[model samples]
Target: MLVDIRVQEEGFSLDAELARLAGVGLDVGGIGLFMGLVRGDGGLAALVLEHYPGMTESMIARIVAQAGTRFGLLACTVIHRVGRLPVGAPIVLVLCAAAHRGAALEATEFVIDWLKTQAPFWKREEFPDGQGRWVAARESDEAAAARWGMDGPTES
Candidate 1:
Protein backbone atom coordinates (compact mmCIF):
# COMPACT_ATOMS: atom_id res chain seq x y z
CA MET A 1 0.00 0.00 0.00
CA LEU A 2 1.09 3.52 -0.74
CA VAL A 3 0.71 5.99 2.13
CA ASP A 4 1.75 9.59 1.74
CA ILE A 5 1.56 11.78 4.80
CA ARG A 6 2.71 15.37 4.98
CA VAL A 7 2.54 18.22 7.45
CA GLN A 8 3.52 21.51 5.94
CA GLU A 9 2.73 25.20 6.02
CA GLU A 10 2.21 25.48 2.28
CA GLY A 11 -1.00 24.92 0.41
CA PHE A 12 -1.49 21.87 -1.82
CA SER A 13 -3.01 21.42 -5.23
CA LEU A 14 -5.97 19.10 -5.27
CA ASP A 15 -5.55 18.45 -8.97
CA ALA A 16 -1.99 17.25 -8.51
CA GLU A 17 -2.88 15.09 -5.54
CA LEU A 18 -5.77 13.44 -7.36
CA ALA A 19 -3.68 12.77 -10.41
CA ARG A 20 -0.96 11.21 -8.30
CA LEU A 21 -3.35 8.93 -6.49
CA ALA A 22 -4.89 7.81 -9.76
CA GLY A 23 -1.50 7.08 -11.27
CA VAL A 24 -0.58 4.57 -8.58
CA GLY A 25 -1.94 1.87 -10.93
CA LEU A 26 -3.43 -0.59 -8.46
CA ASP A 27 -6.66 -1.33 -10.26
CA VAL A 28 -8.25 1.21 -8.02
CA GLY A 29 -11.92 1.65 -8.72
CA GLY A 30 -12.63 4.60 -6.43
CA ILE A 31 -10.89 7.40 -4.65
CA GLY A 32 -12.50 9.11 -1.70
CA LEU A 33 -11.45 12.56 -0.60
CA PHE A 34 -12.19 15.06 2.13
CA MET A 35 -10.89 18.60 2.23
CA GLY A 36 -11.30 20.65 5.38
CA LEU A 37 -11.45 24.42 5.11
CA VAL A 38 -11.00 27.16 7.66
CA ARG A 39 -14.43 28.61 8.28
CA GLY A 40 -15.09 32.35 8.51
CA ASP A 41 -17.93 31.94 10.89
CA GLY A 42 -18.68 34.59 13.52
CA GLY A 43 -16.37 37.21 12.10
CA LEU A 44 -13.34 34.98 12.43
CA ALA A 45 -10.25 36.52 10.83
CA ALA A 46 -7.94 33.56 10.60
CA LEU A 47 -6.84 30.33 12.20
CA VAL A 48 -3.41 29.40 13.46
CA LEU A 49 -2.50 25.75 13.70
CA GLU A 50 0.46 24.14 15.44
CA HIS A 51 1.75 20.63 15.82
CA TYR A 52 4.76 18.83 17.31
CA PRO A 53 6.67 18.16 14.09
CA GLY A 54 7.82 14.55 14.00
CA MET A 55 5.39 13.37 16.65
CA THR A 56 2.42 14.70 14.73
CA GLU A 57 3.42 12.99 11.53
CA SER A 58 3.97 9.70 13.31
CA MET A 59 0.53 9.78 14.89
CA ILE A 60 -1.11 10.55 11.56
CA ALA A 61 0.81 7.73 9.92
CA ARG A 62 -0.47 5.29 12.50
CA ILE A 63 -4.02 6.41 11.86
CA VAL A 64 -3.58 6.03 8.13
CA ALA A 65 -2.12 2.59 8.62
CA GLN A 66 -5.13 1.50 10.62
CA ALA A 67 -7.45 2.76 7.93
CA GLY A 68 -5.52 0.93 5.22
CA THR A 69 -5.53 -2.30 7.16
CA ARG A 70 -9.21 -2.07 7.99
CA PHE A 71 -10.42 -1.22 4.53
CA GLY A 72 -7.72 -2.87 2.43
CA LEU A 73 -6.81 0.42 0.88
CA LEU A 74 -4.50 0.50 -2.13
CA ALA A 75 -3.25 4.00 -1.40
CA CYS A 76 -3.85 6.86 1.02
CA THR A 77 -2.68 10.44 1.33
CA VAL A 78 -3.02 12.97 4.10
CA ILE A 79 -1.88 16.58 3.91
CA HIS A 80 -2.27 19.01 6.79
CA ARG A 81 -1.22 22.63 6.90
CA VAL A 82 -0.01 24.61 9.86
CA GLY A 83 0.65 28.30 10.61
CA ARG A 84 -1.83 31.14 10.23
CA LEU A 85 -4.35 30.59 7.48
CA PRO A 86 -6.94 32.99 6.17
CA VAL A 87 -10.59 32.14 6.13
CA GLY A 88 -11.70 29.77 3.35
CA ALA A 89 -8.21 28.30 3.07
CA PRO A 90 -7.79 24.62 2.95
CA ILE A 91 -6.64 23.08 6.22
CA VAL A 92 -6.45 19.35 5.64
CA LEU A 93 -6.97 16.76 2.95
CA VAL A 94 -7.60 13.02 3.27
CA LEU A 95 -7.67 10.77 0.24
CA CYS A 96 -8.16 7.04 0.17
CA ALA A 97 -8.11 4.72 -2.79
CA ALA A 98 -9.39 1.17 -2.91
CA ALA A 99 -10.48 -1.51 -5.30
CA HIS A 100 -14.08 -0.84 -4.41
CA ARG A 101 -16.08 2.31 -3.79
CA GLY A 102 -17.35 1.23 -0.38
CA ALA A 103 -13.89 0.49 0.97
CA ALA A 104 -12.47 3.71 -0.35
CA LEU A 105 -15.29 5.81 1.08
CA GLU A 106 -15.29 4.07 4.44
CA ALA A 107 -11.53 4.36 4.82
CA THR A 108 -11.63 8.05 4.03
CA GLU A 109 -14.33 8.63 6.60
CA PHE A 110 -12.54 6.57 9.22
CA VAL A 111 -9.24 8.37 8.80
CA ILE A 112 -10.84 11.80 9.07
CA ASP A 113 -12.87 10.86 12.09
CA TRP A 114 -9.80 9.61 13.90
CA LEU A 115 -7.79 12.65 12.93
CA LYS A 116 -10.34 15.04 14.37
CA THR A 117 -10.35 13.28 17.70
CA GLN A 118 -6.81 11.98 18.01
CA ALA A 119 -4.41 14.11 16.01
CA PRO A 120 -2.19 16.30 18.19
CA PHE A 121 -2.92 19.52 16.38
CA TRP A 122 -3.85 22.69 18.20
CA LYS A 123 -5.84 25.49 16.63
CA ARG A 124 -6.25 29.08 17.66
CA GLU A 125 -8.97 31.29 16.28
CA GLU A 126 -7.96 34.86 15.57
CA PHE A 127 -10.42 37.70 15.33
CA PRO A 128 -10.27 41.05 13.59
CA ASP A 129 -9.88 42.70 16.97
CA GLY A 130 -6.43 41.16 17.36
CA GLN A 131 -7.64 38.65 19.90
CA GLY A 132 -7.11 34.94 19.64
CA ARG A 133 -8.17 31.98 21.68
CA TRP A 134 -7.31 28.32 21.61
CA VAL A 135 -10.07 26.20 20.17
CA ALA A 136 -11.25 23.18 22.08
CA ALA A 137 -12.53 19.90 20.75
CA ARG A 138 -16.21 19.91 20.05
CA GLU A 139 -18.55 17.36 21.52
CA SER A 140 -19.92 16.73 18.06
CA ASP A 141 -16.49 15.75 16.86
CA GLU A 142 -16.08 13.32 19.74
CA ALA A 143 -19.41 11.77 18.96
CA ALA A 144 -18.48 11.37 15.36
CA ALA A 145 -15.37 9.42 16.29
CA ALA A 146 -17.28 7.41 18.83
CA ARG A 147 -19.53 6.17 16.04
CA TRP A 148 -16.49 4.45 14.64
CA GLY A 149 -15.73 2.82 18.02
CA MET A 150 -13.00 5.33 18.84
CA ASP A 151 -12.71 7.19 22.09
CA GLY A 152 -12.75 10.94 22.56
CA PRO A 153 -9.56 12.89 23.03
CA THR A 154 -8.14 13.04 26.49
CA GLU A 155 -7.22 16.32 28.11
CA SER A 156 -3.56 17.09 27.90
Candidate 2:
Protein backbone atom coordinates (compact mmCIF):
# COMPACT_ATOMS: atom_id res chain seq x y z
CA MET A 1 0.00 0.00 0.00
CA LEU A 2 1.18 3.49 -0.79
CA VAL A 3 0.31 5.98 1.94
CA ASP A 4 0.70 9.72 1.53
CA ILE A 5 0.05 12.00 4.47
CA ARG A 6 0.26 15.78 4.37
CA VAL A 7 -0.50 18.47 6.90
CA GLN A 8 -0.34 21.89 5.31
CA GLU A 9 -1.63 25.39 5.66
CA GLU A 10 -2.26 25.88 1.94
CA GLY A 11 -5.41 24.77 0.23
CA PHE A 12 -5.26 21.72 -2.01
CA SER A 13 -6.53 20.97 -5.48
CA LEU A 14 -8.53 17.77 -5.49
CA ASP A 15 -8.02 17.18 -9.17
CA ALA A 16 -4.26 17.46 -8.86
CA GLU A 17 -4.17 15.07 -5.97
CA LEU A 18 -6.34 12.52 -7.73
CA ALA A 19 -4.19 12.73 -10.78
CA ARG A 20 -1.21 11.75 -8.73
CA LEU A 21 -3.05 8.67 -7.54
CA ALA A 22 -3.83 7.71 -11.10
CA GLY A 23 -0.15 7.87 -11.92
CA VAL A 24 0.63 5.28 -9.25
CA GLY A 25 0.29 2.46 -11.86
CA LEU A 26 -2.02 0.40 -9.68
CA ASP A 27 -5.14 -1.35 -10.86
CA VAL A 28 -7.46 0.63 -8.66
CA GLY A 29 -11.04 -0.31 -9.42
CA GLY A 30 -12.59 2.23 -7.09
CA ILE A 31 -11.56 5.47 -5.47
CA GLY A 32 -13.24 6.75 -2.32
CA LEU A 33 -12.81 10.33 -1.28
CA PHE A 34 -14.15 12.50 1.54
CA MET A 35 -13.72 16.26 1.77
CA GLY A 36 -14.61 18.07 4.98
CA LEU A 37 -15.41 21.79 4.91
CA VAL A 38 -15.85 24.47 7.48
CA ARG A 39 -19.51 25.05 8.24
CA GLY A 40 -21.09 28.50 8.33
CA ASP A 41 -23.57 27.70 11.05
CA GLY A 42 -23.82 29.44 14.44
CA GLY A 43 -22.68 32.82 13.21
CA LEU A 44 -19.20 31.56 12.69
CA ALA A 45 -16.52 33.75 11.17
CA ALA A 46 -13.68 31.28 10.84
CA LEU A 47 -11.96 28.34 12.43
CA VAL A 48 -8.41 28.26 13.67
CA LEU A 49 -6.67 24.92 13.77
CA GLU A 50 -3.41 24.38 15.65
CA HIS A 51 -1.33 21.30 16.03
CA TYR A 52 2.04 20.06 17.17
CA PRO A 53 3.56 19.77 13.72
CA GLY A 54 5.68 16.63 13.95
CA MET A 55 3.35 14.82 16.30
CA THR A 56 0.28 15.49 14.16
CA GLU A 57 1.86 14.03 11.05
CA SER A 58 3.13 11.00 12.92
CA MET A 59 -0.30 10.30 14.38
CA ILE A 60 -1.95 10.51 10.98
CA ALA A 61 0.74 8.29 9.49
CA ARG A 62 -0.05 5.60 12.01
CA ILE A 63 -3.72 5.84 11.21
CA VAL A 64 -3.00 5.42 7.52
CA ALA A 65 -0.76 2.45 8.18
CA GLN A 66 -3.47 0.82 10.23
CA ALA A 67 -5.98 1.34 7.48
CA GLY A 68 -3.61 -0.20 4.96
CA THR A 69 -3.19 -3.28 7.15
CA ARG A 70 -6.93 -3.67 7.55
CA PHE A 71 -7.92 -2.98 3.95
CA GLY A 72 -6.54 -4.01 0.59
CA LEU A 73 -5.62 -0.51 -0.33
CA LEU A 74 -3.68 0.30 -3.51
CA ALA A 75 -3.05 3.85 -2.42
CA CYS A 76 -4.22 6.29 0.23
CA THR A 77 -3.82 10.00 0.75
CA VAL A 78 -4.78 12.19 3.68
CA ILE A 79 -4.51 15.97 3.65
CA HIS A 80 -5.46 18.10 6.62
CA ARG A 81 -5.15 21.89 6.71
CA VAL A 82 -4.25 24.02 9.69
CA GLY A 83 -4.30 27.78 10.43
CA ARG A 84 -7.40 29.94 10.04
CA LEU A 85 -10.02 28.95 7.53
CA PRO A 86 -13.16 30.70 6.44
CA VAL A 87 -16.58 29.09 6.21
CA GLY A 88 -16.99 26.87 3.13
CA ALA A 89 -13.24 26.36 2.93
CA PRO A 90 -12.00 22.84 2.75
CA ILE A 91 -10.37 21.56 5.93
CA VAL A 92 -9.62 17.92 5.31
CA LEU A 93 -9.51 15.40 2.48
CA VAL A 94 -9.16 11.60 2.50
CA LEU A 95 -8.71 9.44 -0.55
CA CYS A 96 -8.52 5.70 -0.79
CA ALA A 97 -8.00 3.51 -3.82
CA ALA A 98 -8.56 -0.20 -3.75
CA ALA A 99 -9.35 -3.22 -5.91
CA HIS A 100 -13.00 -3.12 -4.83
CA ARG A 101 -15.46 -0.47 -3.79
CA GLY A 102 -15.95 -1.85 -0.31
CA ALA A 103 -12.31 -1.64 0.71
CA ALA A 104 -11.87 1.82 -0.68
CA LEU A 105 -15.01 3.11 0.99
CA GLU A 106 -14.35 1.46 4.33
CA ALA A 107 -10.72 2.57 4.45
CA THR A 108 -11.70 6.13 3.59
CA GLU A 109 -14.24 6.19 6.38
CA PHE A 110 -11.88 4.59 8.87
CA VAL A 111 -9.09 7.07 8.23
CA ILE A 112 -11.30 10.11 8.62
CA ASP A 113 -13.15 8.80 11.66
CA TRP A 114 -9.89 7.99 13.41
CA LEU A 115 -8.35 11.30 12.49
CA LYS A 116 -11.26 13.18 14.01
CA THR A 117 -10.96 11.58 17.39
CA GLN A 118 -7.30 10.69 17.61
CA ALA A 119 -5.34 13.42 15.83
CA PRO A 120 -3.71 15.96 18.10
CA PHE A 121 -5.26 19.08 16.64
CA TRP A 122 -6.95 21.82 18.61
CA LYS A 123 -9.65 23.92 16.98
CA ARG A 124 -10.97 27.34 17.89
CA GLU A 125 -14.06 28.80 16.31
CA GLU A 126 -14.23 32.52 15.77
CA PHE A 127 -17.72 33.94 15.96
CA PRO A 128 -18.95 36.98 14.10
CA ASP A 129 -19.32 38.78 17.43
CA GLY A 130 -15.53 38.69 17.79
CA GLN A 131 -15.63 35.91 20.31
CA GLY A 132 -13.63 32.74 20.00
CA ARG A 133 -14.02 29.45 21.78
CA TRP A 134 -12.18 26.17 21.75
CA VAL A 135 -14.00 23.37 20.06
CA ALA A 136 -14.85 20.28 22.05
CA ALA A 137 -14.93 16.69 20.99
CA ARG A 138 -18.41 15.37 20.30
CA GLU A 139 -19.78 12.07 21.51
CA SER A 140 -20.75 11.27 17.95
CA ASP A 141 -17.11 11.35 16.89
CA GLU A 142 -16.06 9.07 19.73
CA ALA A 143 -18.87 6.69 18.89
CA ALA A 144 -17.87 6.63 15.24
CA ALA A 145 -14.27 5.87 16.14
CA ALA A 146 -15.33 3.15 18.54
CA ARG A 147 -17.33 1.37 15.86
CA TRP A 148 -14.08 0.49 14.09
CA GLY A 149 -13.25 -1.93 16.93
CA MET A 150 -9.54 -1.13 16.63
CA ASP A 151 -7.64 0.47 19.47
CA GLY A 152 -5.90 3.73 18.57
CA PRO A 153 -2.18 4.24 19.09
CA THR A 154 -2.52 6.17 22.33
CA GLU A 155 -5.42 4.20 23.72
CA SER A 156 -4.56 2.37 26.91
Off by over 4 Å in 1: 150-156
18-72 in candidate 1: lDDT tens per residue? 9999999859899999999999998999999999888788888888988888899
Task: Candidate 2: list runs displaced more than 4 Å.
Answer: 153-156
Q: Ten-residue segment with the worst summed lDDT in candidate 2?
A: 147-156
lDDT of 1: 0.91
lDDT of 2 by residue, 76-130 (tens): 9999999999999999999999888999999999999999988999999999888
lDDT of model 2 at residue 53? 85
Question: Clashes in model 1: which pairs?
Answer: none
For candidate 1, the C-alpha RMSD (Å) to the true structure equals 2.5
TM-score of each: 0.94, 0.95
Per the 3 Å backbone cut-off, how many clashing residue pairs does candidate 1 have? Answer: 0
Which one wins on TM-score?
2
Alpha-carbon lDDT, every model: 0.91, 0.91
